[model samples]
Target: MKKILVCGMSQNLGGVECFLMNYYRNINRNKVQFDFLCNSESCAFEEEIKHLGGKVYHVCARSKNIYQFYKDVNEFFSNHAKDYDGIWVNKCMLNNIEFIKYAKRYNIPKRIIHAHNSNNMENTIKGKLQGLLHYIHRRSIHKYATDFWACSRDAGSWAFPKEIMKGENFRIIHNAIDSEKFRYNVDTRELYRKRLGLTNSFVVGHVGRFQYQKNHEFLIDIFKSIYHKNSNAVLLLIGVGELEDKIKEKVHSLSLDNAVKFLGVRNDVAQLMQAMDVFVFPSLFEGLGIALIEAQVAGLPSFTSTNVVPQEAKITNLLHYINLNESAIAWADTIVDSQAIHRELYVQASMDYNIKSAASKLELHFSNICNK
Candidate 1:
């Protein structure tokens, strides 16, 4: 069996974690096994990883102490340098190169750096310094990494220089999912709606972390507009983040306590997707917006901001990209005007964003490298 060390696993419930879980669940583990190297000792996926016959190794968080972080990296590579056939590192920003450097030092033949975000979401002074460090180290990334991967074209262009991106070493890997699991199910939708006491309500749903990038404040404003238009409308907000409390307070301040439902960090997101009449995502930016694709698979009409998401995210006609500068009322009007159209799931997405095909491609890539 070929063992590949995967890095950047975390406890966070986000798009990247969802993508990893999908890939891990679908991959042919008998031929290519995966072990994780994470900053946290425990993660939401750790139990599943162990159940799948993989091990998890912890390292010190780099942001807390840089010196100790490098020390841990060095020690990890020193002890397990030759144990793995390759190293796959998933990063949101292009700013961290310590693990790739260590992998290069240990002569790891296949060092893959996968980019998962189109822009750096951090804005503080420390964040700027880290961005600077990333810029300085980026010049040598091509030298150290054997392969470059990204979730979308925009993300690829964001992380790597144009010249490197044009090379054969670069690959655009879709943020794939099990589309069949999310296919439209009228029975399931009715069941969940009744369970949540939303049988008579027109539900507008948004699934993402309550971070600045998600533009939750704007989402609330849009919901308020929709509520004014139709009193039977209800907003369903999913996922939790640092801004959850603030967003909840905003909901309360708007006197929308009864109309807006906060369903934080749900495991049954696929089932919940059924309950929504329309899905709204007004992110400031994104790598590819995996949730949008999932919503499309679930046959929900989706509205996304054009400022951040690339055109490639539109798999079906149900998805509409609108400008963020539009008024909240305008956004609400558009959502209200568009009739919800049920779509067949897994057909188009299977051609591009299905986890089985994606995992097979990765398995083949690893097999080719092992043979070489």
Candidate 2:
């Protein structure tokens, strides 16, 4: 059996976390087991990983304490690196390549660096400083990483050298999910709608963290326009982040307190989608918008930023693209017009995004590596 140590789980159950969990849940554990290495101790899905027979190890945050972070990381690999056959280090940016660096230093037979974002969308000083290191380290990523994986072509270009990306050692492993899990359901939708006390309202939903990358302020502005056009319009903001309070304050200041609801970190996003009339995403950039894919699977009329979010995410006809520079009213107009779309529950996402098929292929990937 091949035990693959998976890194990159964070405090939030965000897109990258969901991406990893999707594969971990679908992949055959008997053949390829997974363990987690989290920078933060309080990671999402800790209980679930333990239930699946995986171990969880914690390391200090490099951003908070770089010296101790390096010492602890080195100690971890020194003591336990031999217990695993390979390391799968997923990243939104190349700010820290030490995970792969140490993995190779310890002679882990296979070191995989998976890219999950097309750009570094950090806004803070520390983040910006760390983000600059992405450029510094990316040039030499090929030196340590034996395998390269990305969510999309754009993300691959963002993370690795062009020649390495074109080689057999690389692959575009998508942020695939259980498509059927997100398929729209009428009964479940109605149940959640009533639970939220929105039995008679036009619901505009956005699922993502209230972070710079998600552009929640723009989403709120769009919702403000939607509210003005239709007083019954209600905006449902899902997920939590560092900027949640700021977003909530903005909603309040705009006199939208009564019209917006923050439904943080939900487990039943599919059921919640049934109650929504349209899905809006105006991200600054994305590797591949996993939330957009989920919205399309739920048969929602989804709107996303063109050029910023790669076209690879638009697998269904329901997806509509608008430039981010467009006015809030312009985006609102498009989303408002989509309210009449037949909210069906039988939509099928692209087969490539299905978790079972993706899991089978990943199993073979592990088998090939372990057998080598």
Candidate 3:
């Protein structure tokens, strides 16, 4: 079996991690095995990776100690370079190229740089400086890496220049999911609603980490408006992060404590999705919204911010993209006016963003690379 080193694994249960897990679960592990190299010492998926016959290695974080990070990476590649045939690095920002530079030095045949985000959420001076450095490093990406990949066209265009994106080495890999698991079911909706004591309420759902990029503050504002208009309306939030407490405080200040529920980092996302009447995602920006795709698979009408999410995410007519400048009351009005139409949308999701098809295409790509 040919081994590949995969980078960017973390303890956080966010979009990038979810996309990686979906791909890992569907890929043909017998022929091509993946070993993760993460900056943190521990991650949530480590145990499951071990169970699946993969290994996880820890290195120093780049932000904490750049010199130590490089030392650890160099030592690792020096000792175990021969064990892997390739390196696939998934990065949220395109600012760091040291990983790919080291991989090239180790003579890895297939060095792949996969971009997962279109823009960084940070807007500080330090962030601007880092962006400048990213621009400098991106100029030399083709010199160190053999392959380029992204989750969407916007992501690819942001990571690489237009010329490189138009080159033959670039590939757009969709953020696919298991549509069968997310299919809408009335029985599941009833069961989850009863379990959560939401039998008589109209639930507005949002699934994402509590971060600035997700615009949870705006979502809360919109939910507050909805609650004032309809006392029976409930807002269900799933996932956790550093900003959870701050958001909770905001909810308390707005006196929306009883109307909002936060269920952090859930394993039963599909079931929870079934219980929702509408999915609201008012993100500041996104490379590709995976949760929105999952919501469509669950047959829920979704409202997202325009220019943030790509149009390719709309596999069904259930998705609606609105401008961020719109008032919270406008968002609330749209949410209330929209009616949930129950249907098995998994068939369309399967055709547009299926894990099986993605895995097969990836396997073929790897095979072709090996043949050459």
Candidate 4:
């Protein structure tokens, strides 16, 4: 069997982590044994990976001694390179160029880098600076990488423009999922919602890190508007981050303490998706918005911003998008009113976002790559 190494910044079960997990689970393990190298020492998916027959390495260097840490990582990669057939950088978080150079020194073949974020110079000042630095690094590292995988077209266009590419070594491969978990059934949804204490009231849910990038503040404003127009509505926020306190304060100021519920980092996201009637993602930008797809699989109506990837989401009956500057009140009114009348649309959305089909596509990609 050929050894395979998957490297990423963290192994925590967020969007990227979850996507990697699903990929690892579905790949042809008999032909390719897998190893995960990540910064975080412990992750929620550690046990799951171990159970599925993979080795997990905690290689994050957080010490003040930068030179020593670099030397240590270089040595570690040098020693382990012989055991791996390919090194797949999950995203551009790892020392991709350095890894490729070291892998060459050790004669490791097939260095691949995956791009997962759509951020660019146009988004933020910090993004602009990073873009300049990334451009330089990409120029330096482009030759060492055998493949550069992008998660979405938007992510590809932002990270690897035509100027940096050699015609056709880059492509978009969506993060896959296990569709069986998100099967839409009213009985199952009702049971899950009842368990979560969500009564007959219409529920709007958002599942993502409570970070500035997610635009949680704007989501809160939209929720407030929804609550104002629809008295029997509730908002459920999943996941926790640095901005949890600020979000709570906003909810309190709006006097929505009773109407909104915050369920911290959850392991049962599939269940929560089933519990939700609708999913609202107001992120400023995204690589592929996996959570929206998850909600779609659960047959829940979704709403996102215009800047998100896979613009086809707007055409899906299960999702709607509004401009960033649009009135939250109007957006909320449209969502609530349409959902009330169009009940059958939810089932169609679930079928459209079928995880099984996505997973099959991923399996094909993994097989094709290994064959090449």
TM-score of each: 0.96, 0.97, 0.96, 0.88
Q: Can you write out model 2's per-residue Cα lDDT over 185-252, one digit (the tens) per residue?
A: 78888898899988999999999987899999999999999999999999998899889999999999
Off by over 4 Å in 2: none
Clash pairs of candidate 4?
A: none
Each model's Cα RMSD: 1.6, 1.2, 1.6, 3.1
Model 1: how far is 97 from its true place, Å? Answer: 1.6
The global C-alpha lDDT for each of the candidates, from Candidate 1 onward, is: 0.87, 0.90, 0.86, 0.72
TM-score, model 2 to reference: 0.97
Per-residue lDDT of candidate 1, residues 1-372 (tens digit): 788999878888788888888888999999999999988657768998999989989988888788888899899999997999999999888677888889989977789998887876766686688678777766778888888899898888778888879898898888888988998888998999999999999899999988777899999999999999899999999999888999999999999999999999999999999999999999988989999999988888899998689887888888898899999999999998765454444335756688889899988888886667
Residue-wise C-alpha lDDT for candidate 3, range 1-372, written one tens digit per residue: 668888878878778888888888889999888899888768668888999989999888888898999889899888877788888899878687777888889888888899887887566687788788777877878899888999899888778888889889899888999988998888999999999989999899999988778999999999999888889999999999878999999999999898899999898999999999899999988889899999998889899999889887888888999899999999999888886365454545754489989887887777676556
Superposition error at 6 for model 4 (Å):
0.2
Each candidate structure's count of clashing pairs = 0, 0, 0, 0
Please state the error at residue 281 of candidate 4 in Å: 0.6
Ranking by lDDT: 2, 1, 3, 4
Clashing pairs in 3: none
CA displacement after TM-score superposition, residue 88 of candidate 4 (Å): 1.0
Q: CA shift at 306, candidate 3, in angstroms?
A: 1.3
lDDT of 4 by residue, 271-335 (tens): 87777777889888888788877777667778888756467344356777777878888778777
